[model samples]
Target: MAGIDLSLKEMMAIDGALGAAVVDYSSGMALGTLGGSKELDLAVASAGNTEVVRGKMRTIEQLNLKEGIDDILITLTRQYHIIMPLTGRKGGGLFLYLALDRERANLALARHRLKAVEEAIAV
Candidate 1:
């Protein structure tokens, strides 16, 4: 299995990736991060997306849905943000976040690659 740094690097290899992070949703902190610019601060994005995850989880619970979230997608005019909560025992309470440039990204493939990255992550 890949460690945090390796997993992050793998994520950056995806087409259109601008930033990536492994975030702790419970505390709203980034445990590991890569490839963010000044305007796309990964730490700040991680914290903000934690709320998005929490809010969706709460809504699911309130609705009593039996299913879990696959991923949360936020499509902007110029970018795509993907929030994938890790479900494995070692990955509990954490998530994988990736940002992609809209013009360069292949959404389906990015999602597919992110899933592989998630599975390979050791912590």
Candidate 2:
């Protein structure tokens, strides 16, 4: 296994983590997943989130922004959804998706940890 393959496991260790997945934005596919309850279909969420990443990428291009997206955070009444695109040379067009319980999550720490996880993912 790639040294970075443990990313999903590390993500699950985060406080309040409800679900986590590595996504292929170009294909709308969840490469790997952990923690989502049955009622919370990770497959569907991963597919839907592809659009979110695409929309943001489009917006940045249209604005001619020089900066790439570090992450995108969606705050719901009870959940926090984070979308982070990967930066690895072999991992273009991929992202890390995390769902957290707002009441129990430390958003700043979770973001920090997610960044770390992104750096470690090999593909």
Candidate 3:
């Protein structure tokens, strides 16, 4: 991993954070999660977003972009969902999923911070 600890705690450190997970996109299963709630299940959200990642990858292949995604942003009325695919040898099928409270979050800062975390994460 990039940091001493490549865990959800690092992600939840961001302002207006909700939940975060290290997920396996191929299987749509969260390897770990933090800040999950009854109203917003991280597992389900992770799975759903896994499909979103797959769709985007498929589209990229069809378009022959021949590049990897930096991040996927979904802006909602109250929330911002960020899906960032991991890179490196073992990073092939992994991603970081972060959910933030839009009103309290600084989107630009969040993206910057997320990128930092992504770089630190090993696999």
Candidate 4:
């Protein structure tokens, strides 16, 4: 399995990746983060996204759906935010949060890369 640091670094190498963070959905805390601009605070973003994850999980339960969320995608005029919950051996109640420039990113590839990163990430 890949270490957290290595996995995060690999995520940053993805095309159009503006920022990446490992966040704890349970506490809305970012354990580690990389690649953010002055205008964007990754820590704060991570915390906010925690609610997004929680809300969806709650919705799924309320609906009594047996499916698991692979990722949550939020599309904006200029950017795309992707939240990928970790499902590997060491990853539980944690997620990989990524920000991408909509103009530069390939959504399909980004999702695929995030899945690979999640699979290899070790807590």
The models' CA-based lDDT, in order, is 0.96, 0.91, 0.89, 0.92
Question: 17-49, model 4: which lDDT tens digit per residue?
Answer: 999999999999998999999877999999999
Please give the distance, in angstroms, between residue 20's alpha carbon in candidate 2 and its true position after superposition. 0.3
Q: How would you encode candidate 1's per-residue C-alpha lDDT over 1-123 as one tens digit per residue?
A: 999999999999999999999999999999999999989999899999999999999999999999788899999999999999988697789999999999999999999999999888998
Highest-TM-score candidate:
1
Model 3: residues >4 Å from true position, as ranges? Answer: 1-6
Can you rank all candidates by TM-score, best first? 1, 4, 2, 3
TM-score of candidate 1 against the unseen true structure: 0.98
Number of the candidate with higher lDDT, 1 or 3: 1
Candidate scoring better on TM-score of 2 and 4: 4
**Across residues 1-123, which tens digit of lDDT does each residue of candidate 2 receive?**
243348999998999999999999999999999989986689999999999999999999999999888999999999999999987585679999999999999999999999989887887
Q: At residue 51, what lDDT does model 4 achieve?
A: 99
**Model 2 poorest ten-residue lDDT run:** 1-10
Candidate 3: C-alpha RMSD to true structure equals 1.6
Ranking of all predicted structures according to lDDT, beginning with the best and ending with the worst = 1, 4, 2, 3
**Over 4 Å off in model 1, which ranges?**
none
Where does candidate 1 clash, by residue pair? none
Best by lDDT: 1
